[model samples]
Target: MNKKLRKWFRGLTAGKAVHFLLALLWFGLTLFPLYFTVVSSLKLDNEIWDTMFQLPSIPQWENYFKAAETAGILSAIVNSVVISLGSVAIMIVCVMMSSYVIARRLIKRAKALNLYLLAALMIPLQGAIVPIVQMVGAVGGKNNFFVLMLIYVGLNISISSFILVGYIGGISREIDEAAAIDGCNLFQTIFRIIFPISMPGVATAAIVGFLNVYNELPIANVILTKTENRTISVALLAFQGDYQTSLSLIFASIVIVIIPILIFYLLCQEKVEHGLASGAIKG
Candidate 1:
């Protein structure tokens, strides 16, 4: 029995060691592109192709400034920030209120309404792009940032609501009753009591919404035709030409765009992880 137990323990240890090595390998693979982008961005365009891994003998810091100027990156960054933040803020408020009402069964047709909202998630945005574009044109909403914000909010509402619903369902009704007893109205109770408690769900929804709006290219490209109104994703196209492209400048632009997102993620990493985990378990 002792000999058999020793052999089993050895096998388990070996298995864990193999898994550890695989995880490291996967991590390296995942990080290689980002590492390459940083290194390549600093090298001259001519040297990029030749020296894939070598450090640049002379770092071209001006590549970033040149890329920014050529692409109107500052304006693009502003547009992206405004649109993403506005959409996320609006989405969170609307979704939280809708989810709260639905989860609490506050209305006569709550079940039906919940089902209808969830159904929206199944519909692909690509299928409705034509109609959306036509509607935007009819209202002169093309190239308008506010219109873009509305579009993003509408697109994200259903999924955000669904996630919030699952999380809201886990909250006890006693909290609502207690808040009411303290002379709080429905809106006040929800905002003061429930909203604070549901930060995990809110954070989860916000992160998802922000990413969706920030990285979305198809809709932004169609809606924002004007150069000044373009987001970073759309503005990146300015670096490409029909015959020749500035490879270093393009890489530098990529790095600049990536920095804000990376910083945001790092700052909110703990909250994001916690929010996702809590939402998954409770939702």
Candidate 2:
């Protein structure tokens, strides 16, 4: 074992050894928090701090049930899914059409309009909270999922357009000409030709928009006042009290809340990676 270890160590150059050790360090740093959360979730409330780094004597599987029931996690999950998915769907459609128009300069002053939309990226949501609340109240839309979804779509358009416009612009205009030559209308060309070719960008925008709406708390807290309309982020906030907090239950809820994001990422992982790679290279 010693001879093999020495041989292996000798085979690695100094830079490779340094990089390997640094990679291992980064891996451990990234993995430890998740390990801690899982371990803590399986422990008793008292056992959590007492044996912070140790395994629980017996797992507390009941914590998940208790957290889910007490926090209304299941319903919150539904609300989040509805709002996030709805918002992403609307944002994608709007941004895609707008981005295509901007990319192709189809509309007058398209560059000016693109710049105007991209300018929203610099405005923080908090800064506009008062105006948003006033606008929503003026329209008599409160505690409404549709309203919230629309707000999400509006907020996300800037970045989504920025990502997609650049991506769509990278595609050859000759394809559009070809589609035109084949007797396809403008909308038909966009749907059939540009849509498939720009899927990576769309995937990227969808993922970003979904994540933004799903995890957003400030706007949701302000607008989704009803218990039934509470999102997962708001539901998690309910776990905290003035005098008492359950760490184990919070950890369990954390685990539950992350499952959907994991599933979504797994589904869109390929497209997102390709989109990012294409953007980096093209940009």
Candidate 3:
């Protein structure tokens, strides 16, 4: 038995070592481009090509600053931040309130409401974009922030509310009864009790919505006509159109466009992971 155990332990150690090496190689493959981008962003054009494989003598922090100027990077960043946050904020409000009402409110049409949201999940964004744009334009939403916010919120509602509602459903009914006994009305209970309890769902909605809103280009490119108002994703197009091209500057700006999203993911990855895990367990 001792000899058998020793053999098994040796085999497990060898397997683990092979697995570790494979994982490290894969990780390096994924990370090298990101490392290259960061390094490329910091180097002079000459340094980039001449010493392409070499690290910078001293880091060039000015690439982001220069790119920021040439690409109107600051203004584009502001527009992105505002739109991303605004969209997420609006999504959270509608999704939470709607999900809470459908879950906790004593409405007779609960089944119908659930069915409606599920149906919404099946509807393609591409199918709705034409009518949605026309409707918004008709409503004087051309170049309007409020209208854009409404559009983002509405488009996101199906997924966000579906997740929220599912989690709300999983929550203990006794919790609701206890809150009611403590003099909480539906509104009070939802805001004070349910939202806090279902925080994982809220975080899930936020991270997903933030990512989508940050990178979305089609609608922003089509409707956000004002150059000053264009989001980073759209603004990146201006660096090189067909008529004129600057490959280096364009890649430099592409590097700039990636930073904020990278920062957001790095900062919120822990929360996002936690939210997903907690929600999965609750669900």
Candidate 4:
């Protein structure tokens, strides 16, 4: 009977191994396009098409430099960085402060404020495109990095604030009251005590906000008229045409754009998950 059971267990294990192998095959199939991009980026014009299906003979390290130099990508990279970081900075301050007030019930009319915040969250950015463009146009920040930063910040606030408020609400009220009894005012208690504790939630919100701003294309497309001010996502369009397609450069440029996001995720994903698991959501 024991030998029969052992044989059954081995059969189950073999079945699981087959399933795992199938899953891995599916994963590779999914990742094929991304792999093609990286490999194609390392090949030249004819080299790209002629050997489109072939692996790289030699790594094309110069594609990185060539793409940057040819596409005015240096300026785009700088613009993208400025816009992303600037948006993140503004988001951190406003969302953190707003979430704190909502979480702590600092406003006497908390219900009204909560309703307002919820209303804002429900209003999608795409729906506001018309008025947003007019406002941005009227304000005359066309093609400016500073203006793009403001546009990004205003657009992202609702969802970021909502998530942050939920995290903040999870924090125990006893801590706030304790700090108050110890001669700490609302500002001090918020900044000194609550804010530090909410760093994880704040990090999570900031990273999401940063990714949104960095990857933004529509608003940037409408607002950014100058080549110098265009974000990398917008600038990647430079490699496309009706007849002539620079597939190699397109692949290289895409790799350049994706690499930064991958790096940021690798570094900050731990902090983000840590904050989500803990109650440190508002600051």
lDDT of residue 196 for candidate 1 = 98
Q: What is the lDDT of residue 35 in candidate 3?
A: 75
Query: Which 10-residue span in candidate 1 carries the lowest summed lDDT?
Result: 274-283
Model 1 regions lying over 4 Å from their true place: 1-12, 108-124
Scanning candidate 2 in windows of ten residues, the lowest lDDT window is 274-283
Worst 10-residue lDDT window, candidate 4: 274-283
Which has the better TM-score: candidate 2, or candidate 3? 2
Best by TM-score: 2
Model 4 misplaced stretches (Cα beyond 4 Å)? 1-30, 45-53, 108-124, 277-283
22-131 in candidate 4: lDDT tens per residue?
99999999899888898999988788878877888987889888788878887887888888999999878888888889877878987678678778877877898888
Q: Candidate 4: give the clashing pairs.
A: 168-282
Candidate lDDT values, in order: 0.90, 0.90, 0.79, 0.83
Better of 3 and 4 by lDDT: 4
> What is the per-residue lDDT of model 2 for residues 1-283, given as tens digits with 9 covering 90 to 100?
9999999988999999899999999999999999999999999889999999999999999999999998899999999999999999988888888989999999999999989988989998989899989999999888988988999999999988888888988999999999999999988998889989999988998998898888999889988888988999999988799999999999999999988798889999998888877755663
- Put down candidate 3 lDDT per residue, 215-241, tens digits, no spaces: 887777777889888888887887677
Clash number for model 1?
0
